[model samples]
Target: MFYLTSGVLFLLVALSAPAYAEQNLLEGGLLLTAAALSVMALALILTLRSLARRNAKLSRQKQSFQRLLAETPGIIAILDKNLLLINASSSLKSLVTEQDHSTLAIPVPLFADANGSIDLLPEIRQQLKQQGIWHGEVWLKNEHHCEAFKISVHNLSSHQGKTSTYILFGQNITKFRQLAAHQQQQQLRDDTTLLPNQLLFIEQVRQAIASCDEHYPSAALLILDFVVASQSEREVRLNEQQILDIATNLKLLVPETLLLARFQHNIFSILVPPHLCKQYNTIFLNQLAHKLIAGFNQVDSQGMRSPLRIYIGISISPNDGDNVDLLLNSALKAANRASEQSDSALCFADSANQQQAPDFLAMEAELYRSAAHGEFDLYFQPKFSISSNRIVGFEALLRWPSPKRGMLPPPTFMPLVEETGLIINLDRLVFRKACQQVSYWQQTGLMRGRLALNISIQHFTQRDFLRYLQDTLTEFELAASLFELELPESIFNHPTIWLRERLHSLERLGFKLILDNFGDGISSITQLRLFPLHGVKLAPALVKYIEQQEQQRNICATLIRLIGYMELDVTATNIETEMQAYLLHVMGCDCQQGHRFSRAVPAEDIGQLLLKENQLLNNQRQLAN
Candidate 1:
């Protein structure tokens, strides 16, 4: 209104003033001077009036803007194109508790931490100057605080001649970020039987592989599925949800450090650190394969086959693919190869994998047929007491008697057995064979040592497998103390409760339990507290160094002392040379087992060797004499 009145008065005065007369000099001068004075008064009044009106508008807008800024959700602020908060709302104001400001605006970096990397102000300024917009996410940190935020700011010009900045807006977005983190956490399968979503599992694999460069890493993706997995048998209901649940349960059953993801309905991706692989065991990977099948067969209480009983396939990083997509694809196809015909897991390693699926399928069919026809046979190797040079036990080793391929080691058909799900029966057959041999020896007084049977990580059923084992022992009439079981380091992969119960039962039945290839498999040793054990097998790696290297000797010596202190027996495996045996004797490994004595042989040969024990253990007689 003031500006309007001033503008009207200026217009009236300009109209009323007469034009300067051209002919009369005095009159012309007088008229021009009057017009100039009126014009000057009008201009001054208009300037003052315009200033007053602008002030009134500012006062109103300022109150409303303040209200809006204060009430808005999250932290909102007006920043200079430099990200220096020219004005801030109450939320941003509260976050800036340390700084004393009459008004609520400040620099965003004030909230950031020392040592935190920030590409904030310059980037914001550049975006604002060139595009007039800035938008993205940023992480801000302080000694006491750190936060993730989403921000957006726009460039604006002020009316003042000075390049004045407009304070824009901001919202904290902290809750949204936390929600995202929570969602990411759900990828992990918990003991509560919660299945990790597919997205979460992939992230875990990527994270595991990412650390491969700096730390221990190797992955064996085992895809368990039906050997003859057709669409379905007419009576067999394909409950996808239940199958997924079973898989999730299996994942939860393993150790926390392991990453378990459902690669597909009948496939699982297990990212195992190379050392954790039981392949390095003295018993080797084939024996490990047998053990896994035995354990997996117990997944159900009734006789129902578990959905988790799928084929096993593995693909390593860089060798399979550097990234997840290519690696998973290759692994899954290998799993398919194992599934379609039944060969445990095939690594995407060689030209043979590139061979058509049909060839592998036919190959799987033959392997299963061979197993069913009793193609595998058992061989026994002796374990001697390092101090006594007395035979204390024998490990039952497996052989594949192939008609076409001749006598093949367990490694030859073991992968195929795991793939075909025939290992469960194979374990049973091997155990029975070993039991019969031990029983035969005990009856004839030809064997002095116990028979050691290797156990699988998966063999502990919630139901009583120990009872069935006892029945077998009774059937064979073998003394309880004469049977021992060997377990690989992967036993830690099982649930604590199940393992504890099974071990207790075995102990109660008087069977000794020993760990095979101890130091070789663990990054950090699995706590012995979780297990009931009689002895441990020092891996060949430890024994190899015990001879020539003082450092290795020290390590072996320390390990022996540690094992002795706990009152647990120690056996050094692969005692290939007399020097290794001497070291074992000096270091106090309770037993020594390897080729230095004899190659693993048939049960009859073992009986003959036992008959000549006095010849083999002359050192003991000398010590006694």
Candidate 2:
């Protein structure tokens, strides 16, 4: 408009000057100059009006932009060329506690590396300058903790023309990050036990193996499983609840520092630290396996009190195999071998054993056939009473007479028996046969007093175990007071409420309970308080160690005194020397059993030995009188 007005004024002045040229040259010149001045004045007025309109429009746009910045959900900021904050939205300012925006010239430490370091600001600025834009996710350190944010920035020229500015926007992504972390956590844990699953366990073992050296020597892998042997290849396995119960009990036995994992339905794995492996030898692991079995035995399977049999396979790193899969395989193979043995219940992996893997299914078939025939025999180990100077009781031990393999010990086929559910039948047969022998002795006046019978946790925990025992005794008309049930120390590992109640019921029903191997595995005096135990059988290890080590002697002495205070009878087992016998007698042991008394013998041989012992006792009594 100013230019148009100026042009029109000049055009009119030029046309009038041509007309006035004839009147006077001087006057025309003055008129032309006045017209030029008027045109200049008009141009100035139009320029001022245009400037006012443009400034009003710019003010309205600034107000709208300010409102948008305030209402935005995320952080919005303007930073100068030096990465200094020129303007920031309220949302951006709310990140900090201070409300003073004046002191906020420099950018906050919101843009960060994955490790939450704010040292990447210079790199971010350089990138923005080179590429005109920068965008990505960054970690931000909040007042209390760190947060995640997706930041975006664009270079812009500032209105002042003094410096360049950056338009920055940041979106909070903390919840997303938390959700991702939770998903990762879920992937590494077991659903039932809430412990780490096999994947994590394998990873831990792999790391331990890789890092193993002279300074950080060895680690051990222990694989535990409950064998369910059947006549067929498809064995009868434990149900989900039974497996869960075993896992729960195992958790109680394992320490918190060690890693435990559920490998399969009835299998669990433990990662033993190098230090522990060095500290504890195979003996300690065998004891641990025994303790685990005892703890597992307390869980009732399908209304039965005895828990399923658990086999532990162990393989030390470097010694067995260095890698995860190889070590796991070796441990599994050793566990299979351990399943064939009854004592200790653990087998360490070795190259020789790995070469000869046994056929468990065939063994299971052989066991079933053996039980079907009357091929199983019972041997008696006499419990000699030091006070009475006679054989007061005998512990009934089972023996399998295999046509193809001669006499098989309990460890040879007992695990298979339990796995095949044949323990229920075999245990009943043993009890009935033992009671018959007792009744014969009482009728013939050959022997007297209680007969102690070893009961498998599997058979003992049966819902009908008590009924079966009562019926067997009644069938023979044997006095319940004359019968004693010897339970291994493993039974005390973790007795459930129901198991505790059943044990008390056994006492009420006239069955005497003897805690066998009292100091072995996880058994302690606490078990004595929890159950209705009439006697305790001191572990053979304690008696043997006492003879060799003074510390062991003191420990045994303290235990004997403790048991004496409880008023429970004590029997020391595995006494092979007169020195051991004399030491036990001085320690106040009521009875002793082992090679010194007699090795387990046939029922007929036991009867003759008892007769000889009774005659000897009578002569000693007469001499004393």
lDDT score for candidate 1 against the true structure: 0.65
- RMSD of candidate 2 to the true fold? 16.5
lDDT of each: 0.65, 0.77
lDDT per residue (tens digit) for residues 164-216 in model 1: 46545555666887787666666455323345645666876677667665334
Highest TM-score: give the candidate number.
2
User: Residue-wise lDDT of candidate 2 within 1-625, one digit each (tens)?
Assistant: 4544555666566666776563565555566667777887888999999999999989989887787778887878888787777777776676643574633686657646556545667788778767777888877665654667898988775433334877889888889899997787789887777778888888999988887777557888889978554445345778777777778887889877778898877789998877666532443454455567677666454676553567888888787888888889999998888877763266779654333224444566678887888679998888888767778788888999887788978877775575557888898889988888888888887665688888888877788998998888888997788888988775654456876888888888898898888776677787787778899888877998777899999999999999999989898988899899989899899788889879999987866797787788789889999
Give stretches of model 2 more than 4 Å off: 1-202, 207-318, 322-349, 359-361, 418-421, 618-625
Off by over 4 Å in 1: 1-360, 461-464, 523-526, 615-625
**Pairs with steric clashes in candidate 2:** 294-490, 297-307, 304-461, 305-461, 306-461, 342-411
What are the RMSDs of all candidates, in order? 15.1, 16.5
Lowest lDDT sum, 10 consecutive residues, model 2, at 352-361
What is model 1's C-alpha RMSD? 15.1
User: After TM-score superposition, what is the CA distance of residue 99 in candidate 2 from its true location, in Å?
Assistant: 34
Model 2 / residue 225 / CA error / Å: 22
